[model samples]
Target: MATWSDFENAEPEMAEAGKKLLYQFGVGLAFLATVRKDGAPRLHPICPTVVNGRLYALIVDSHKRNDLRRDGRYALHTFPPVDVDDEFLVMGRAKLIEDPEVAEMVRKDQVARGMTSTNDELAFEFGIERAMHAKYPGGHGTWPPKYSIWKER
Candidate 1:
């Protein structure tokens, strides 16, 4: 697994493209998929933040949070584009961020971005195992969209 920084350092363009797709509306948003205790998949909207080159999400106490606590495996897909089929997907494992200093930094970043967060929210940092970015310049009309896939090497 690789940190966001490591992925970015290896493939800056891919990382930036993925980041752009993730934060398409000036705020980060993605569909986070986790595994339920019954081994089923659970999907939910999440606001993902890339701070100091690390990907973090603030999750309140819920089934999603509990899911991560029990099983860290997750896959994140960008919300569909308004006028295009361009998409980004990442597969990774999440680690709960417990260090006070790191959480404080994230809080400051969220405040600066005008995003509201509560004290009950827990932070989780994602470690990327691989990612795929697809660009559909011609939208649905295109025969095949350009694809760029990256894996930790």
Candidate 2:
């Protein structure tokens, strides 16, 4: 289990490529895939934040959160670009972010955003096990795009 910082240190180019695709929309937009209790697959949109030397996502009380709690394995993929198929994908483990200060900061941010704030809020830190980024041409559908991939040693 490696933090985003660790991943960056290990493979800066790949990490940067993935990060760019992730935040291409001016926000950390990606879809999170988690394992359900019954071994089914569950997915949800998430905003990944890279701060404090790690990757975190604010997922309030929900089945997705529970999935992470019970099983940390996850796969997160960036949303498709408006035209190009450039995208990023990461597969790794997730753990609850328990730092009080970090939690407070997130709570405040949520409040400022006018989103519902509650004690049920759960912050998760994602550890990167592997990642890949694809760069497509014509900013649209293009197969066999350039791919940069990395994995933990």
Candidate-wise lDDT, in order? 0.89, 0.83
Candidate 2 Cα misplacement greater than 4 A, ranges: 106-119
Q: By summed lDDT, which 10 consecutive residues of candidate 1 come out lowest? A: 106-115
Name the top TM-score candidate.
1
Per-residue lDDT of model 1, residues 97-141, tens digit only: 999889878777766766788877888999999989999978666
**TM-score quality measure for candidate 1:** 0.94
Q: Model 2, residue 42: displacement in angstroms?
A: 0.4
- C-alpha RMSD in Å of predicted model 2 compared with the true structure: 2.3
lDDT of 2 by residue, 40-107 (tens): 99999987767756888788789999999999999999988776778788889999988888976766
